[model samples]
Target: MNKTNRKKFYDSQTWKSCRKLVLKRDNYLCQLSIKQNKLTPADIVHHIEHFEDNPSRALDMDNLLSVCSSCHNKEHPEKGRKKDKRRMKSRRMMI
Candidate 1:
């Protein structure tokens, strides 16, 4: 596994709420690869960290990025947010 361990920042409801705050902070613009591309708000909120399991960093506005779906999918090729969440949740159950 990647030792980078990005999931360490999403642990509580705080992360979800923080995500909303960050989205509003960025004006719904994708922080990643959005400087030139013209896209709509239908994009995704790309988390700076691949894994979001740590609350402290999860709510950090700096750690969140408002990205469109295309950019978000490009960043994470195989796993979607919903799938990732489910996988992460199941993994937690085993631990």
Candidate 2:
């Protein structure tokens, strides 16, 4: 889907309801935090399998994860990783 359509889907009532359900199911706690022996409130309901890659499972509860912004970033690092690579290249060129 295009960016516009993807944004619309996220803004839709269905997505909203699903997000709420995931949060409730996870008890509003960041799932990653539990592994580290910490409790953190989740601010996002992230797709375990990225929505773009597997749109069919977009609404699957088992495919959703309640996560904080930090954990979400770690899970989906493509964008950040690219930026980091660019910065590293620039630093190397300067050295």
1-95, model 2: which lDDT tens digit per residue?
68997999899999999999999999999999889999999999999999999988999999999999999999988858988999999999999
Where in model 1 is the C-alpha error above 4 Å? 1-12, 52-56, 80-95
Tell me each candidate's TM-score: 0.56, 0.85
* RMSD per model, one decimal: 10.7, 2.3
Best by lDDT: 2
**Candidate 1 residue lDDT tens string, 1-95:** 23443444344566667777878888877766557766567356665764434534545677778888777787777657688789999999999
Name the lDDT of candidate 2. 0.94
